[model samples]
Target: MIRIVSLLLVGLLLSCDEDVLPKPNSFLRLEYEKATYKSFDDKEYPFSFQYSKDAKVIEKKKYWLDIYYPNLNATLVLSYMHVKGNLMFLLKDAEKLTFKHMIKADDIQAVPYENTQSKVYGKIFEVYGNAATQIQFHATDSVSNFMTGALYFYAKPNYDSIMPAVHYLKKDIVRLMETIEWKKEEYF
Candidate 1:
């Protein structure tokens, strides 16, 4: 009788354990589309780009802007900064600056890798950590946009859990980079 009771208790515990385990979160299917808007800095400045309608643009000021891409009802933030100099120069500067900051902060483990580079345009650097993964890219076009800009994407702590959404958003960001057009004028 004790052996049968023990077996029944084990079965009950196994069933309870399954119930306690968290369910996998569902992800939304992103519908991407082309988007554009004038420069928030100056109405006369004609800054435009293609992005998803699901994404919302938040222009904090003349120099700073953020594109929030929502996933599973959560906001994934991609920030853009307009800087002086050519795309290559800006990227080199950013690498140096990021390295310096990481060293100073004692975050040596946060060192980034050049994930990829564009012989035709720019490069992307990806930094991973226990808390988040940051992907930065730079690009410029002589025939299209004149300004050098940086794109930053910050994902959640455990990237594996959000891999699907992260991948989708990364693709969206790439499209945005391709369509970026800076207005004529040195805001600096």
Candidate 2:
């Protein structure tokens, strides 16, 4: 009886050890050390932004840039595209070509623009908590259109891990939108 009880105790201990340990929080923490900006001379137009040193600028096309904002535990991706021509026309083209694709992919919902002309400035939409936002701002001369769009996604979905970094990076996005200077030369 003593030997049987000892074997039972050992078996109980082994079973307890087999129980899996709870995993640590998988969420990542992001660090926004500093702000950096860059512009490519090879393109027909000039584009600039304030970004983190760890972030990468991916050139998808001659005129498009995919700015990858890296978080210690999340990802923030923004795409900037510059085009010249009728502002309304370019926006429509983007809606059909780009925005529609996102909707089809179930990344975003199909929403119409809500035009607003406030005392400060004219904004087409008041996108709230959106996964993405596209803006087509006409140049001061109204001769060209400057388009910059951003796609926001949580890489880890841990709000605690990414919110701070995202908040800091969003300021850069606002700065880029407010300070866009389009090139005078026409590519096409």
Candidate 3:
């Protein structure tokens, strides 16, 4: 009986030797609604483009617009300037704005865009890192119309956290740039 009891205790001790570990940390999966786009055609403005219906276009001024994405807590600040022999200045300023984030950005990729048929030409700068602005772009007719846009989030700079939203909005920005239509000189 002593031998049997000792064997049973050893078996019990062996069975209980397994380590108890806390559950591994799990991450939240972020998902956003499917995007739909709408045309932005205001005769009052010199240009028109298509933007995601998910965003609201608030006219900050005569030629300035705030494309607000409420669900994502982000905004695309767009400003328009008549070339008036200041095309170089506008382009330089747009590039300057993009490079301002170089300290925090791992890389700044400038994607050149040109639609010869529409006379729309520009460069879309993609800033990778924990920068305040993840995207910046400038479009110009090289003669009459120039426009610049910058993407900004309401929260602190967290690249990993905001990457999804940035990618989604980046598509929208590219769509807007692709669909840009400059009104006739007489319309201005």
TM per prediction: 0.51, 0.48, 0.86
Tens-digit lDDT track for model 1 on 1-188?
99999999999887774445678988765653534333233353446656667767676555445666553333434343444445455556656644543432323232221212321245444444333334455554433333333333354355455545555665665665555556665533
Residues forming the 10-long window of minimal summed lDDT in candidate 1: 111-120
Could you tell which candidate, 1 or 3, scores higher by TM-score? Answer: 3
Per-residue C-alpha lDDT of model 3 across residues 1-188, encoded as one tens digit per residue: 99999999999888886688999988777887777899999988899999999899999999899999998999999999888898888899889878989999999999999999999999999999999999999999999999999999999999988998899899999999999999988755
Write the residue-wise lDDT of candidate 2 on 1-188 in tens digits.
99999999999888785657898867455565667665434454454334545567677776676666555433333333444556676556555544443432334333332222211121222122322332222122234334535445545333344446556755655554444544544554
The residue pairs that clash in candidate 3, if any, are none
How much lDDT does each candidate structure score? 0.48, 0.46, 0.93
lDDT of 2 at 142: 34
Off by over 4 Å in 3: 1-24
In terms of lDDT, the best-performing candidate is 3
CA lDDT, candidate 1, residue 11: 91
Best TM-score among the predictions, by candidate number: 3
Candidate 2 has an lDDT of 0.46
